[model samples]
Target: MTGFCNMVIISLFNWIYILSFFVVYTADAGVQNHHVDKQNNSKRLLMDENYYTIMSRLDNLTKEVEALKKENALLRHSPIAFLAELTKTVSGQNHQIHFDQVKVNIGNAYYPSHGNFIASVNGLYQFSITACSTANHYVVLELTVNTSVVGKVLAGDTGYDECSSKTFLIQLSSGDDVFVQHKSQGDYLLSASAYGFPSFSGVLLRAL
Candidate 1:
């Protein structure tokens, strides 16, 4: 009876040791799982932050591209340019020289009948004029902007035909008038095909 009781006590101790080992192993495994879950959460948060940053940058780039496209389209559609030539001899002082022969009037800003360039928009403009005079006759031409003289040129020689030219850059408002007129001096002009015809030309440099 004593031997049986001792064997029974030893068996119970072995079972207790095995149960304690299993409980320790299970607790360690739970700790490991919790650590892994924390690492995965950190990784997920970092990935989400990077994605949002990249998306914001891409959206700003798209907006900039759209603005550039609109500016390019506006520049392409609105163009102002014109060129005309004096077709016949002009006489008289203070006369408005009519460059009636149209060469390239892209914007229709130049009027051959009235000999004037009317501004369509407020802008900085460049204008040029070429004048030729008959032999022994001197001509002084003036470029006028709304009755204001902005430029002048004189063309004449002692026994030969002469030519002179002038260019001007001015700011203009919409509906402003620009034209070439003879100043006080000799007024006869030559119109020979051998020489280039007297010409008036203008272009819009920039919109105000």
Candidate 2:
């Protein structure tokens, strides 16, 4: 069933290709001068008819191509999406947070296994990090973009709920990396329980 559907789509694309050439060729034909003597009134009339016919065909083909593009877009899925969170508890003073489980990764630009989010395009981005601290301990996380600290989240202690989250909005160029890092703050650590663990998430605001 899938094979048949794919074949049908391929045929449609081929039709589009053929139609595009015909439109361009026909338009060019009308502009190119062709020699005709004064006695060739009938030949000129035939040429006019042919031009009109070609134009009508071109218009029809253009509409068909637009329709096909719309349908094709609906059938196509976005290959680049950025949305994920950590599945395991990650904590280290100088260690990067390895998310380990990606919920939605369209471009595969982010690697949870490596705790890195490499920007695939230059764009404005909004990043967020939620660090859960162990009871009586502390958690301080830093959001780093290209080795520069952009934001920080400090939470955990017997006083607070032991959850700290921070969101940052920044402009990133292609190949830049944004990630969360554990900052040295005593013996405090990031913790996760039945509710949820630490997570890092971000999305492209707009491509530059």
Q: Pick the candidate with the highest lDDT.
A: 1
Error of 2 at 175 (Å): 0.7
Taking every candidate in turn, the Cα RMSD to the unseen true structure, in Å, is 5.7, 26.7
Cα lDDT, model 1, residue 135: 85
Error of 2 at 137 (Å): 1.0
Could you tell me which residue pairs clash in candidate 1? none
Model 2 lDDT tens row, 102-172:
77776788887778899887777788888777677677778898879899888777865577677888899
Candidate 1 segments exceeding 4 Å error: 1-77
Question: Which 10 consecutive residues of model 1 have the lowest summed lDDT?
Answer: 70-79
What TM-score would candidate 2 get against the native? 0.57
Candidate 1 clash total?
A: 0
Report residue 19 deviation for candidate 1 (angstroms). 51
Write one digit per residue (lDDT tens) for candidate 1, span 78-151. Answer: 77899999879887787888898999898889999999999998888999988898787888888999989998
Q: Any runs in candidate 2 off by more than 4 Å, and if so which?
A: 1-80, 90-92, 159-161
The CA root-mean-square deviation of candidate 2, after full C-alpha superposition on the true structure, stands at 26.7
